[model samples]
Target: MQLKPALGAIVAVSMLAIVFWQQTHLDPKAPDAEFTTLSGEQIVLRELGGQPVLITFWATDCRACIEEIPDLIALHQQFAHKGLQIIAVAMPYDIPSRVKQLSEMRKLPYTVALDIEGVHARAFGDVSLTPSSFLIDRERNVVSRVTGRFNLADWRARIAAM
Candidate 1:
């Protein structure tokens, strides 16, 4: 009985440490992450110089990520002509085939890429959480980061301001 209590305490402490680490990982300015688009073409961050860019890291099996797709799609359509560029990068653990399939099924009106080697995640401070996102201004500076999901109204306002 005593051992069980001690183990539980240890787990709780470990969980706290993990949470702290994840918090510390937040707030990083996204680096010039390179992406290979589904069309086998490469897009470097520096190339998107004159547009507000949204780089979202997600996984096929992540419910929150999936839930945010429609909103992202709509937002892309609403803002693309106004210089908004949305890029969705699949998490390293997600199957490339599934990611492509989902992208097709949803008709994602944005660039979809597979981060099979985790380079994109590392470029954004080794983000391991699903639905993580970085919002960059026209000058290519990261202006916002969302770890789980974004509120639609708030997202639109931010993009509008960009």
Candidate 2:
């Protein structure tokens, strides 16, 4: 009976440590992967180091991803002129034609790339979930990584700070 309490306490402590580590640790460098935008424009991550970049992995069928489109567009409009670069990358399984059509329909005002070969996704820690996002600072260091929907206002403040 005493062992159960002790084990529970240990587990709680380990969980707290993990949460703390995740909250404080940031990736030293963003991937130097190359992205081929839907319009055939090539973008290299390292080349855009002197500006804040938000890279989001998404899919056409994901409702959450679709819902965040407006927030992304807003972010682009608010910060593009201020040196914020936003890239919306479609997942490997997403059809290229669908991705293109949706981008056109929604009039996404940011760089949109398709990861048909999954190379970009793999380079970014094998992101298998939709709506995963990473914020890289001007120094090319990854400052934030979120795997689900996030607060637009919070992200806005973060970018503004960068």
Candidate 3:
């Protein structure tokens, strides 16, 4: 028995839809979500309660996002001692190994989290594009959000004024 090309395509598409539907319906957030550090230790958000946080959503494949990483590293170094925490949330994609490799290669001093289910993205407001940043105050309230490539000078100035 041979299947026609159109029928084969339809079956393949239907299977793909089912897989996407299942994955999409799953919740990505945990009330107690704990992120693993580069050294493989898990740390919960509540642990960093007293410090302001800069959360950036990015993907390994995003060129524009990759370009801002060095600046982010600079910012982290400059403000970490000032009670500021920088968290890079890696968007869900097929590049966990690559992300880890890059993080190590860059020698990132800040924490990194994997958005395996996009829960962070939705909870923080679906930052669909890469390099989106959210500035959360010490109280965990989002004070500012920026999408697309950003200027480090402007970001630092805003945080300094806060």
Per-candidate Cα lDDT values, in order, are 0.85, 0.89, 0.74
- For model 2, the stretches where C-alpha displacement exceeds 4 angstroms are 1-26
Single out the weakest 10-residue window by summed lDDT for candidate 1: 21-30
Residues 1-162 of candidate 2: C-alpha lDDT, one tens digit per residue: 899999999998986665456445545688888999999999999899799999999999999999999999999999999999999999999999999999999999999998999998888777776788999999998888877786899999999999
* Residue 146 lDDT (model 2): 79
Model 3: per-residue Cα lDDT over 1-162, one tens digit each: 356988999988986665455345433322234666546777676676767778788888889888988888888888888988888889877277888998888888888878777777776555566777877776665666667777788889977865
TM-score on alpha carbons, each prediction: 0.85, 0.84, 0.73
Deviation from truth (RMSD, Å), model 3: 8.1
Q: Against the hidden true structure, what lDDT does model 3 obtain?
A: 0.74
| Residue 95, candidate 1: C-alpha displacement in angstroms | 0.9
Q: What is the C-alpha lDDT profile of model 1 across 1-162, one tens digit per residue?
A: 789999999998986675467657655445777898877878888888888999999999999999999889888989999989899999999998999899999888899988989988887877787788888888877877777898888889999998
Ranking by TM-score: 1, 2, 3
List where candidate 3 sits over 4 angstroms from the true fold. 1-33
Q: After superposition, how far is residue 121 of candidate 3 from its true place, in Å?
A: 1.4
RMSD of each: 2.9, 5.4, 8.1
